[model samples]
Target: MNSIGDNCTELKKKYDSCFNQWFSERFLKGDTDDSVCAPLFKIYQQCVKDAMKVQHIEFKEIEGDVLGSDKEQKVPPKSGSSSS
Candidate 1:
């Protein structure tokens, strides 16, 4: 998949390929250490962060949990429902 920043696509691809190789060859084999792709990931991450800054996207916005899974959500009672 292409990266959010076009300039980082190559870096992202490198990291993805490395991760895939590591996951299949090492992780699945019980060698769970993932530092093999850490450098590539860091480079790609920085590139994406730079692109986001250029586009005026705040880091806090991306940091938000859109799924709301961390907090309990109360469902409102349905209309016409009454306590017995």
Candidate 2:
């Protein structure tokens, strides 16, 4: 997969590594502490946010306060209001 930020490919990879480890080692083990990958996630998120701005990607919040909550529900048909 490609990096979300143009210049932060390495940073993203580094963060991904940390995240995968955390998920398998801590989170799967019932550890909910987020301190392990907090710093790395911050850096990766900032880089991607900057890239999104540079690419003119309009960032908007979802009305239901959900991320990727059901693609069919989020996308409406041009003819009708079907939430299927």
Candidate 3:
């Protein structure tokens, strides 16, 4: 099941398919072009944004705070930091 909604499932699948193909064929082949899946992804993104709005989700705030932030967070040291 999609996290967005049932209405976006089909679009998500289509976008996923396009993305997988692009990743495997073009990306792996060192083709950095993103035109192939751009359209599909754009539509899928719009659908997800609309669904999130309907669910009262603040997509921009979530995205900005989670991903757009440049602050570097520290990772805790492992219990055993020494090499075996």
Query: Using Cα atoms with residue i matched to residue i, what is each candidate's TM-score against the true structure?
Result: 0.77, 0.66, 0.71
Please give the distance, in angstroms, between residue 17's alpha carbon in candidate 1 and its true position after superposition: 0.1
What would the per-residue lDDT of candidate 1 be over residues 1-84, giving only the tens digit for each residue?
788888999998899899999999999999989998998888989999999999999898777565657454668899999978
Tens digits of per-residue lDDT, candidate 2, 41-66, equal 89888888898888887677323455
Tens digits of lDDT, candidate 3, 8-28:
999999988898999999999
Reference-based lDDT, each prediction: 0.88, 0.79, 0.83
Off by over 4 Å in 1: 69-84
Per-structure clash totals for the candidates: 0, 0, 0
Clashes of 3: 0
RMSD versus native structure for model 2: 5.4
- Candidate 2 TM-score to native: 0.66
Candidate number achieving the greatest TM-score relative to the actual structure: 1
**Range of the 10 consecutive residues with the lowest summed lDDT in candidate 3:** 63-72
Better model by lDDT: candidate 1 vs candidate 2: 1
The TM-score between candidate 3 and the true structure equals 0.71
Number of the candidate with higher lDDT, 2 or 3: 3
